[model samples]
Target chain A: MHDSAQDDVTTMTFEAFADTILPGEKRFPGDVTVAGVAVGGGAVASGAVAVLRTDEGGMAPALDNLAEALNGHAGGYAAERGLSLDPAVPPFVALSFADRTELVARLTAPTHPERDIWVSVAMFSTIAFDAAAHLHTVDALADGHPGMTTMGFKPPEADGLWRFPEFSYGRQLARPHPDTTPSGSPA
Target chain B: MTAIESTDVVVVGSGFGGAITAYHLAAGGARVVVLERGPWLTGQDFDQDFKFGSSSTRAFDFTIGDGMSVLAGNCVGGGSVVYFAAMPRAPRFVFERHGSIGRRMWPAAISRDTLEPWYDRVAEALPVTRQDWSDVPYAGGLWAAACHHAGRTANPVPVAIDNERCVNCNWMMSGCRFDAKRSLLLNYLPAAIAHGARIRPLHEAQRLERSDDGGYRLHYTVVDDVDYRVEVGGGAIDAKVVVLAAGAGATPVILQRSADTLGPMPAAVGRYFSGNGERLNTAVIDEDRVREVLGLSRSDGVPYEAYQIGKGPCVATWDRLDGSLPEYLRYSLEQLYFPPGFGTILAQVPDATGPTWFGAEKKELLRHWKSWLTIFTMSEDDNEGVFGPPPPTGNAVRVSQQMLGRGALRYRPTENTLRGWAASDAEVRDILERDGLARVMPWTNDVVGAYTVHPLASCRIGDDPATSALDDRHELRGHPGIFVTDGSAVPGALTVNPAMTIAALAERAVPAIVEAARQRGVAVRYGAPAPDGATAARDAVLPLVAGRAGR
Candidate 1:
């Protein structure tokens, strides 16, 4: 009955931990230009807000999805980028605006407090959210909070993989390349 | 207005030690009152994934060891409610060694037999069991693999967890989502309440004073929705006894504050604090090897690996605090990592002062990670103070922690220690690289002082009242009736977790306390009639998972 065998991330139905710990929040006006589409590797840019939804509350395991989306199902993304990240960790992606070109950074050394621990910044991105739902309530400070009163928890580094055409990308958050990939399924 | 009430025994601090103590006394017929600073967290209240506390308030903003930002649960359950829930006992020989260090009775005089039963009592209550390996045999592979590689498996630890309730919260540090970890929330505190112990959470104790005839006048505050503190003026509770189970850090502060009535300044108290000679060292297991030892479903999010070194199953030792790991064991791990799993092995050095402290400077800490097969080792230090670290330079002395890696005790090293860690840096580097983990500085293998899990000997017990804080039975000599049943009474270091010992001592002192009160002519009848044997209707207990699980 114990999922102790699974990674720390898999033990939950919807990932509420990373959501809370690293913490991410975003709010948009309901009237903002909204478009929803699937997300792929690369970056996800949307004026309206959007969210990722996996088929199940459990979602496809983080690594599997990361591998599919970040490197493309058959390792296409890595092949294209010619990057050398270990496959040991599933390909995970990060949620970012088009111009924030910096690839998120992560701590990989063991001496660090969380050396072997795995976290998929990219994968957590494509989950379900209600941009429309957010508009229903206001954080009063959205207009007055000093700094990032909200954030879509960009990955500190690429820890997992993504599922192509599997992402929900739109201004209301948009569906990115995944939906637009040549084949109906992200190719 | 002050709400005053009295009881046969008053327990302060809702940690495992105090909770257990209260539970025993209440069940034994004494009416008990328990005070905690945190709220009750039940399964339903567990829904907060990131904000740990149902309310986003942090555990404790108070400063503890060396300006470190401390966090102890303010919830009804206390420390156990927030700990990783490991219940190892002090080694049998730990208390038998006061003479070796030029001190008498380091293992304060107490019967092991009296505490033996409680150990089992506690284990059963938690329904604590070993982690099940069938489904994810390799998940918690790290510890097991390391043990085998180290040849330390014969004494693997027995965790106080209900495996059935465990889930992949992957955030044990934040707190367990599954109730499997028998933290105070699920065990002691509940049983105490069942035995008629009343716990008032969010009642932050700010000051304490002994009333003339005895008992206590506690000044506490109440926190409401608006985060406003409502002062409940000091009120006197004419109880016959009070047990201070507040943690090592806070316990000393209490004694230090009431130095006059509490008794003479003991050369102990907060002295010789060790984070269990606790260390964070890594054993190299490649990516694939990591999988072999610790089974991880890449998709699952984290390795379900359960790994640990040092004491367990029965006793804890200053076993860690240093990496004098035998050579053969090291070879065994290297041998185990036959096939490559992860590229390099990882060893995370957790600190009692991580982030949030030291300006929470992540930038500086990140730089220390370069080329190191990292791990932190906390060792037991014998030289402690009666009063605490000297002031003026207390700040500067705190920063000297960097010197711990090579700081040696004045005398001989413990039976299984490096005589001089300062000379082993090259050896460690060679040993690790030869074994395929990482290359690091020369003193990596030296004798670093242990950070300790807060073991203490303040108000330590002794025969002579003039020299120590408390006498043979944990009673402050001056007050005669006042007692310290928590870690505040230990006379020496414990090579294992002190909870079991603390509980045992506290339980042992009760009989004596009652006897004294009787001798003093106080009517000590066991409290109100017990309802049918079933535990009293539960207190506002909280579960690990919000609503998903039942208490």
Candidate 2:
């Protein structure tokens, strides 16, 4: 396990990175990780850090390294623009949202040798905000995952399975197969 | 190693190719054992999560190469377990067309007419169903309507699915939890099991060698499905006949590994690869136009409307195989829907109006996420791809034990393929923008180096050993009992999804395999006889071609 202080810096850096990709409102008072540049819930609120920490995300071990690299880029970006980063937060978190976005563009540029790594980081952020990918569909729906809820995803029935007897076209254009049963299985 | 086990036949992989072959051979009364490197995941185990890479339990393996990345399912039912279930047959021209060398890519013995009976057999088992107009999901309907407005037809494809049971969850690629999708697990595999074939999940085949008694010895290891960690237990299985159905991305590696002990493999072990010219594009439908098409009035107080792309089957393809395009340039357009989480990944729309891939504009686009349509295009690409030793520079995943130290795929689109892609892109953009119904966006600016799930023809079948890994009989040249029956054996791009064609080829090869086993003094009983009228239909279509001289 990483030291708590180091972990905090890494978490803040990722939170800021995810925020640049998909911004959201601040979680609560005194929350310094999220930039809160945009309106509705975003990658931070959608559990981007939690998703990244999961074993399935395969990003946990690389978090520290990624944060260091991001901060290095942020420092370079700040130096190139003749702007000083805030001393209170991690280097990446200290930059303005616009600066962060521009730095990310450079990191994800097609010609960059490490483009795939940065792209993967951005993708994980989007996955958290879009699908709550780490959570089970039922559990995510029940918990009202910000992304799923915002997308208006329908919840499953009590049996934990979705069954839509009604057609999306308002009316059925073809009859069900002769072997189809009431439960929808082929008899 | 544990004591060596003996079986009449040992099959690698449990996908469409392996499952079909196992079922036929096991039914024929041959003692069969199937070794699958991935776990046996059922409907209960499936979820909408986009589990990818080697770490995921679903084992969606990714082999990132220099110019192309290949995705293949590493599970019991193989590609069929995770496929979209589209079962369209290859057009006749795929077999008839000649390559740039002026030589026909496919063997003369293998053609649509010859494979019709085998295709029919697979269709009956899976019970392929063509979706009715009512059965078409919203995304498919939108595509059809767009095509109609553009004076083209978007037809519902025949799919290997029980449509009645489908809840339109749009999770077909992730494996259907509803058991609605007719994957090989639902049919061929169960049948194979019932016929007494032993399916050993998490058993990875490492190497192959000839046994002292003229049979083949398959060396394998027990692996943990989650991390693919090789466990302590391992043994060799000796069998009279060995079938390599480990998919296009894998079969070549296995053969390459066996070359030293089994004798030097043919030069064409990993040549003529194809990604099936697969490309993904997106179109954002205009909300007002969407409402107009759905007949919704302005008075309706719905602030944000959903297109319900996630509530239907994965794809409803638009057939563009008309003769307006040259034979090599024929392609099909499929309106695909990824589930919520996975769908947003496609949000990287290359040419969005403002602030592409981030910020307020991207968030706004996410707000209307339901209105986005992902269009997947598949064309008949020139098989210019090759699978060889990993290049020194690129990041390559270790896919097999001894592929001369990790196999890597290198591919670049030929001139014809690029033209086909451009034409298809223009057509899709035109259809989407008909009367300004939607804003079109290319998925990626890098069209030549795109990823594909449909990696094919790595160990293609042909008449010449110099250019083909397997002969027309699906057997490796100079190695009679070793056969490759999978997407690896397909000669060229099928111009449609290759699952059905792969299954059909496996079906066609089974009888020959059984006969050969018998001739080799191995007592093999034939089972799962051809469907009634299949033989007569095949006979009427064309006489069975005699074995060519190359063998």
Candidate 3:
């Protein structure tokens, strides 16, 4: 885990986070393999609980990390940043922020490609969800920090989230949901 | 177990204004509840296919903007979801109106200085860019030509989109065929949602009632569009503040409902209304120039293929002739509007009625696609015909709106508009002739027609309560915690797209609202104080390009 101020996420044991935060009970599926987690039926999710089920074995650690992440988000200052694929908030998970982002490093490493990517993506999505409920708008983090644009870093994508069809293209262009056309182009 | 409802700000009509306001307010730590009357559409749902466009039908939702009344979007992303995505700043005269909101306009609204930061913020976010100087029927070149012909440099239009994805599909108004336009649906709204704001779509704000504790009450309905599987039912929301950003037409309507509950609108509430009457004129170029310049090939052009014009097609052709537009006026310009290079082989087929004339046009004898350039003209509407004194017998309540505090006062059109000063017809005609293009038929008569979908001034901002409705800052004169920041607050029209102006103004107004809320002793929850040093430096030192004078 990074420093408390840097990243509040703790390395939780996956089982605990799922058992406590995610409601439905299930075992890690014994099928499918990636870096190496069976994909079949071990994970269980219905609504908000699904987010909890993303990280399988590290369940408790995931919960602790998510909790610490939530604690870091004081109010609506930042949103839960996560990958573009997470589900909408279902009002549970006790989140304060709304921002989301999918951190690819956690659930699936580049070396471990899995056929059922949803499983891993889903796991990371919960991290973002839990984070979002706790975080503020990214601007909150941006405060006092050097603006990326001024520092020659490219501006953030226009739309932070992916609109359904072009969600895959989010990082490629300025907010895939919004087209790159100057106004007056047809939808 | 009763319905849990609260609000820092209650934004009505989630179009450009509402969506933006909600997002910013929520981002700023205010509990914002956005009320949108239309169903939400995501890119996946609104496939960028012509077949989808042909199959899907949309409805008319209107909004008022600087000096004009225009169509508005109603989805969660607000107007950006369905906007043309152009971000031209409001014309100079628009910012300095003489009568209502001009001199007395809110101090924060527009100043080379005040708008500097905001414009930078919005422009960067939308990537509002200059026209591809090379595109045929080139709007940039044409404007330059017209300006040279008129003594004004061509006013380059600032667009709020990623130009790379502009498929030149000619379906801008139909919706981005490609998700290229950086509309709020794809930008601000998502960010706001990410920032904790709650958006309730398909929720039409029917009334604004006052709760027993004097908090605000909003009653809205969840409507269902039978065509779409979307269901909407937003019960009632009680909030601390109410922001009316329903654009031009609907702002007055929402206030009308408030009038029933809050009392007679402040003296200037719904007084001055204007529709920046926008009319289009054009020159049909030799099919070759249209294709070559626009980078489109006519032969390979799809039948009935559309072309791109500046601030291209958002409004319908206005012929004011008491009948449908004559054919030459309707399709001629549309056919010739695209430049020559895109799919050039098909675009310049030379036969208006060729077998390849696309879709049903083949059977209908439609003049196939050609390339042309258009001159879009926006003029002020009649104030008397539009803006009038508040009616005597409307539902009058007791607003106690006694010009209570210092805010925007007057609600009148800008000086230039009031004087009916616009680019001369002779100048326009001269530009047409100089360009070697002729106004083909019926359109010739329609050039003089005053029409537009962008409406403005239904509620002009001013400082004195007696003379205007709200003060310049758009804070309604008497209504505590009530503000109007969207198009409804703009007094006049600009030569460019108004959405950007509205969004930028909203950006400026946001901090003021936040500060004011704090001053009024309202509880603010911005989470732990944004750390002391580095992060604060970043936020404080934003992209501030100070003086971007309007051309």
What would the per-residue lDDT of candidate 2 be over residues B259-356, giving only the tens digit for each residue?
77899887777778888887767777786775565332222433114355333333333345643556666777877765554335545554555347
- Which window of 10 residues has the lowest lDDT sum in candidate 1 chain B? B334-343
Count of clashing pairs, candidate 2: 4
Who is ahead in DockQ, 2 or 3?
Answer: 2
TM-score of chain B of each: 0.67, 0.88, 0.71
lDDT of 2 at B93: 67
User: For candidate 2, what is the DockQ-based docking class?
Assistant: acceptable
Best by DockQ: 2
Tens-digit lDDT track of model 1 for B14-68: 7765776677567655777776655655554543222112221223222223211
lDDT of 3 by residue, B1-551 (tens): 56858776788867666766676567656777888765666665553221111112232332222223234454556567656665655433344444433343434345544664566556655556654443322333433433344333332345665656664444455456467777676766777777787877667676677777666788776666432222345577887778887666556666765777877777656666555534444444444433343332323452112223333532211111111321111110111222211111111112333212111121111122232344455544333214332222111111111100111112333444433323323345554454443332112211111234456666766555665576766777767677787777765544345677777776656555655555544555221111111233224323331221000
How should the candidates be ordered by lDDT, best one leading?
2, 3, 1
In candidate 3 the C-alpha lDDT for residue B257 amounts to 59
lDDT of 2 by residue, A138-187 (tens): 78778877876776766776877665454344323223323332222221
